[model samples]
Target: MALMITDECINCDVCEPECPNDAISQGAEIYVIDPNKCTECVGHYDTPQCVEVCPVDCIPKDPDHAETQDQLRAKYEKLVAAKG
Candidate 1:
């Protein structure tokens, strides 16, 4: 599943650079995660890098963008291909 930064986010700017897929970005009030780009670090790491670095523990699985491991891997592959 894709992760989301909630209202609890502190705007610390730590999670943005940690996302391998470049999903996290600054919103009007807080950081936001692009579900289309988020893979929960499936293809990049064992754990979600944003979740790992967030001091507020605001990053959580996005219920609206629920996806399985295979789906995440496919997204990761697509993102990589787009980058090249």
Candidate 2:
């Protein structure tokens, strides 16, 4: 599943740099995760780096954008291809 940054986010700014996909960005209030670019680090790492470094524990799977591991890998591949 794609991860989301909840309202509970403290905006300490650690999560943005941790995203391998460059999906996390500054919102009006808190950092936001772009679901289209989120793969939960499936093709990049064993665990989502943002979630791993998040001090507030505000990152969670987005039920609204649920995806399986295979789906995430496919997304990651697509993203990588697009970059090249």
Candidate 3:
């Protein structure tokens, strides 16, 4: 599943830099995660770095954008290919 930053986010700006996919960004009120770019760190780490570093535990799996691990991996590959 792709992760999402909830309204509970404190906007501390910690999660943005931790995202390997560059999916996290500062929204008007809190941090936001782009589902299209979110791979749950499947290609870069064993765990989601944003969730690991989030101080308020606001990051959670996005039920609206549910995806399997294999899907996440494919998304990661697509993102990498886009960059090259």
Candidate 4:
């Protein structure tokens, strides 16, 4: 599943840099995660980097954007390909 930033987020700006997919961004108040870009670090890392670095643990599974491992891998591949 893609990860999401909850309202509990402290806006510490710590999670943004940790996201390998560049899915996290500063919103009007709290940081937001772009589900389309989020892969929960499937292809880049063993775990979600944002969640690992989040001080408040506000990053959690996005139930609304649930995806399988294969799906996440495909997304990751597409993202890296686009970047290159």
Q: TM per model? A: 0.97, 0.98, 0.98, 0.96
Clash counts for the predictions, in order:
0, 0, 0, 0
Clash pairs for candidate 1: none
Superposing every Cα of model 4 onto the true structure, what RMSD results? 0.7
Residue 51 in candidate 2, Cα distance off native in Å: 0.6
Q: In the order shown, what is each candidate's alpha-carbon RMSD?
A: 0.5, 0.5, 0.5, 0.7
Model 4: lDDT equals 0.91
- Candidate 3's residue-wise lDDT over 6-58, tens digit each? 99998888889889899988888888999999999998999999989988999
Report residue 42 deviation for candidate 1 (angstroms). Answer: 1.1
Per-residue lDDT for 6-28 in model 1, tens only?
99999999999999998888999
lDDT of 1: 0.94
lDDT of 1 at 28: 95
Q: Ten consecutive residues with minimal summed lDDT in candidate 3? A: 24-33
On the 0 to 100 scale, the lDDT of residue 53 in model 4 is 88
C-alpha lDDT of candidate 2 relative to the true structure: 0.95
Q: Candidate 1: misplaced stretches above 4 Å?
A: none
When 2 and 4 are scored with TM-score, the better candidate is 2
List of clashing residue pairs for candidate 4:
none
User: Candidate 2's residue-wise lDDT over 4-84, tens digit each?
Assistant: 999999999999998999999999999999999999999999999999999879999999999999999999999999999
Q: Which 10-residue window in model 4 sums to the lowest lDDT? A: 51-60
